[model samples]
Target: MSVRIGFIGVGGIAQSHLSGLLTLPEAEIVALCDISRQQVEKAVERFNKEAVGKEPAGRKLEAAIYDDYRQMLRREKLEAVFICLPPFVHGEVEEAVIEASLPFLVEKPVALSLSLAGKILDGVLKKELITTVGYQLRCGSFMDKARAALAGKTVAAIVANRFGRTPGVSWYHRQDKSGGQLVEQATHQVDMLRYLVGEVDTVYAAAATRINNKDNPEYDIFDSNCMTMTFACGAVGNFGNGTMAHVGVPPGLNGVHIFGDNVQVTIGGNLRIATPDGVTEEPLDKDMMVRQDSAFLKAVAENDPTLIRSDYLSGVRTLAVTLAGEKSARTGQPVKVADLLAAEAPAAL
Candidate 1:
């Protein structure tokens, strides 16, 4: 039985998901919706090209396009939907999806604030719908190996960093729209930390706009940020992010490194472990997004939400950490994740 899928946003990230969906034999993209008609049409053409010679015999490679996801959802009988909108455009689409009781795969930084994410989560829990967030790093084999290597060892510290240029999207530079660089760009690192290590306890952060100025006046987000976090397992971590990086420079120092008593693990494109004996780098084979999509499809097919690694509630926790860091950066005080979650616990799980 093929899972009829509907896409809420056909942006670049959603296109990545479409590539993954094309690889699944039981997945079919039946509808696509976006605010821009041109983007919708372009996505339809791109998806059609990708779907060529990839569908089951007699299955037409056609998708209904709409300017609004609500309209598409009402018109199309879909088994699952993918919400790939940006940080700010979340609440209403999610509410509609949950109201229909349809399982969905939503992109990261679920919302700009915890309060909005909590309300959507409330609907999700009440409806008991299968949900997965786009924390694709959790679906990789390297993560599996990292977890196995750190099974019994006590982690002492973690170092995570992200250095890159500002994205072309204008909203990403605004604090209110994308929740700053920490919430929008460095969220992958934050979520990966939570997955590999335990939950974060406290977060203190400092940020400043050092490079982006008159030349890049539109860039309102902080150009550099340093966040310090403590894990519940007595592990302390620091993550540094910067958007003023030179474009030609290779992004080498852009991942998490964990230090334990006997073994130190480095997680990025590949997993590297340094032990008393030697260092080993395990090259990754599977696409993380593909694995993530496959897991979500399986969960929906089997009616089990646990099959997906990062669900709505877990994603909300990750959001809580990043949002706390943003708050800390603004207030110059360490923010407790528990306190943040408790303050917005009206719809908490």
Candidate 2:
């Protein structure tokens, strides 16, 4: 039997997963929910258009649509769910999903704050639900090569940067809704740092909202931000990001550069490594999302949580690091990731 699936949000990220699911024969999305009725209709139309000429040509593409996720969850019999909502719209929906006892795949920056993310993580663990986070960089071939190149080398310092234009979505610019660029956009790089380096111990950040989009008052997120991190392994990381530049323009580089004793690895447009002998470079494959989606579906289908690369707990840690960075930026003091996570644990949860 095919794994019945439901989507809690129909947004751009949801399209990526929807496109991925179209390629998988074992998964069928039967229910969709979003606050916008137009978005829900558009999602249904897009899915049907893509599914029409596929192998399952006769399969029904029409799905029940609801403006509220709770109604969808209560009415649909789903084996798995995809929580694709914004960072601010997290807590209650996740609790409801856990209550339903269905495996779920959530997009990253799990919540706006570490306390809320920790609360969600506690529920996920208590219920032992299968979960996957949308940190696709962990599933990339570039990461695999980078890991192999740094196997025996002692990484000393890491540098990560992201230069991009503001998101088209208005909510992304609001720090309360999207958790700023560090927590929302550059999270992939932070998670990549944790995945490639080690867990972050402390974060010190400096940020400013210099470039004001006078037209939009909701644009309160920082335009330029610099963060310094100390890893548990004693490695230091210099990570910074800016929303003042275009994403694909010149001087806009986004990726991690790892430096070891006598070796250096750069992962951006491509994966490159330099040693005493020579430099090796390979174009990075662009199928990480496909691999990510495949893994989550397989985990849900086979009842194997091990298939997922970045699960809920790991995502929560990444979220904590970003939240700490945000706090550091606001307070002008270094914040410890461990302390943030420890303070978030509720006695009952």
Using lDDT, give the best candidate's number.
1
- What lDDT is obtained when candidate 1 is compared to the true structure? 0.87
lDDT for each residue of candidate 1 in 150-190, tens digit (9 for 90 to 100): 88999999999888888887678777788888898799999
Instruction: Itemize residue pairs with steric clashes in candidate 2.
Output: none
Question: Which sections of candidate 2 miss by over 4 Å?
Answer: 50-60, 246-252, 346-349
Q: How far out, in Å, is residue 79 in model 2?
A: 0.7
Off by over 4 Å in 1: 50-61, 247-251, 346-349
Expressed as tens digits, the lDDT of each residue in 175-280 for candidate 2 is: 8889899999899999998888879999999999876566666689988899999999889989989898743646525778999978899988888899999999
Error of 1 at 94 (Å): 0.6
Worst 10 residues of 1 by lDDT: 52-61
